[model samples]
Target: MTPVSLWNRSFVLWLVGSAQSRFAAALASIALSFLVLHQTGRAGQMAVTLACALIPNLVMPLAGAWVDRIGLKRPLIGANVVRGLLQLTVGGLALLGQQTGQDVPLWVINGAAFLTGLSSSVASPAAGAALPALVAPADLPRANGMMGSLAETMGLLGTFSGGFLVAAFSPAVAILLDGLSFLLMATLLLGVTLPNRPEGQPTSSSLWQDLRAGLRLMRRSWVLTVMPPLVLLVNAAIGPVLVVTPKLMETLGVGPRGYGLFLAMEGAGMLLIGVLFASLGSRLPLRACTLLGFLLSGVAQACMWLWPTYVPLLAASLVFGLGIGLINTPLGTLLQQGVPAAYLGRVFAVLSAVGAVGMPLTLLLVSPLVDRWPLSLWFGLNAVGLALGGAVWGALMRIEPHIPALAEERSIEQPQPRR
Candidate 1:
């Protein structure tokens, strides 16, 4: 069979298996993070732990280049295997010490977190870059919509289930489940046979060289110019909200269950919107939808700050999700449609690296401010930040002149590459 037809079948298998595996890991991740904070009562320490987790994202440019050198399937399978082992190790350490009331040491836990983060740095971009081979150009958005929607759904379900597992079985069990899921995901990845990129591209020696190429794409290219930053700004504000919610509840005299309900409600809004986007995303103009999503999310954040009560907060969360779904659904389709398959992974990594910088700083800044500011005020700033991000994208649309909501659609159909 031709690679195209083989990939058609593989795509279906990967989608189903990937979603199922992701569901488990997502639940485990949240459960593990929650366990750390709850058991240690040290939120900052957990933030630092997660900081180590995010560290790989900043360095992913090099990682992506490395993966391209190996086949995409190998890196994916290897990363999953390593991740599964790391999770199992952590779970085992905790298991052996169950009777002593002593848990895994902080450094050990952080190391495991680091490994999981690193695996993601390798796997995510490769999977994204690999999608062009999966289906034809016309089906790209539909495939990407399915991918994004399933991810959102899995994320919501995992988080809720993670919270439940933490409440029911223990964080160790949650971690073990996470490990097994990764193992299963790895097995599935092994089944996929990726194509080798056509040769005679730049043999960039330094990671910095590859990074510069990516930076140039972001600066000069039409599609990436708007997409990544649109994500970054929305991504940046997320950290503060996560921090502020618990603090708000604590100050408001509510318990953890109340906080979970609030978060789940917030997630629920996104869940509904994700389904909506999956259904209608292909019909929307890509650029406009992205720009508007950021704007709406900004408005939602600001509105939440205006009233930190249950109703407004929930409304804001729903709006945030709606905006996110619109922007995120078509993104992979844009890349798969726009970028040459060979260069896609490196470009994805660099964009991710650049975009991740904002989130860590946002997290760092939010952590210090939360202790001093009123929860209402802290969240209000995040809302303002989201709004400003929206404005920037709106301005980009006006200035670029040629770039529009359905620019990708027009570009793909024209038969002439923009460059």
Candidate 2:
């Protein structure tokens, strides 16, 4: 297969649009948090508003099935338009409240958050499922890597800008800007062309049946079945580590500056690895990349457990971020290469829903224990679990030849369209 240029028209349009949308999302997140706290004068209300956003994840499977049945482009475009309108509504309400000398109601904000999230549930899977159509299969790793880097860069920039905008103007202004970003993304997407659904593909099946078929595919594949739990474990570990990092920084007498450095190092590491993947990831074996990621993450966690000092912890954070990039980028490629195009949206949705379900549950379970238990113990346990998880995955691959074979079979059986 001839390698496709990464700068191809469709991909460039998608990439630019995605980057701006991600930036808007990050900005909106910070603005929303500040807005809720300012209006309600309570941190708990902020948490509740955040939870409202998460509530839509419960219906992600349905959203995914719907995307698969209809196709990607329209759903992607519609989601952005809807989210933009929702954000505009919130901003308008906030502006009205300011003029009227009354606070925007907490429930209204929360409701908008829920609706925005629901729109994203559709957008997320549609976007992921659209990539294979926009770029060649061999370019998936690089494509995904570029997207990851864009997200991280935009997120960092957006967070900083959001803080400035909220402070200098108002959260309402930042939120209105976010709404504009979404509308811009939708406009850009209108210029890109996506493939129509393949002729003869079944679409009359009920959503439940489509969802069930997606699930059945997951169950049939060993890699699909086990990978989610492995990812969940990693997510579980990362969340608690974030929650406790502030206390850890305090213990080291490093203050907020050091805490910021710690985060910056992690983001820098992720960004570096993303660049590397974009440049050279196509030559690498997916399984080896994934295993190395897990191992590196485990080692980084162990370093955190062994050396409680500020410098070492920062180094560990960097390594952990690199591991995360390694794990996610290749895994995304593996799925895109292996899954049937017809089912891609649903599969991505199921995986996303799993992450959504796992994160809060893990945080809830681990948060209470943090105050009482030694943090090092938590790190040690995660280190062992992550390392063992990698080894176990390797063992599973050795015994189950179907993993690589499945991908090869899919490539041969249903060749991707040449863009």
Highest lDDT model number: 2
Tens digits of lDDT, candidate 2, 12-62 = 898898888767766676567667756654444544565567568768888
Give the alpha-carbon lDDT of every model: 0.67, 0.74
Per-candidate TM-scores read 0.85, 0.79
The global Cα lDDT (0 to 1) of model 1 is 0.67
Per-residue lDDT value at 363 in model 2: 56
The lowest-lDDT stretch of 10 consecutive residues in candidate 1 is: 403-412
**What local lDDT score does residue 117 receive in model 1, on the 0 to 100 scale?**
84
| Model 2 lDDT at residue 341 | 75
Error of 2 at 263 (Å): 4.9
Please report how far candidate 1 places residue 388 from its true position, in Å. Answer: 1.5
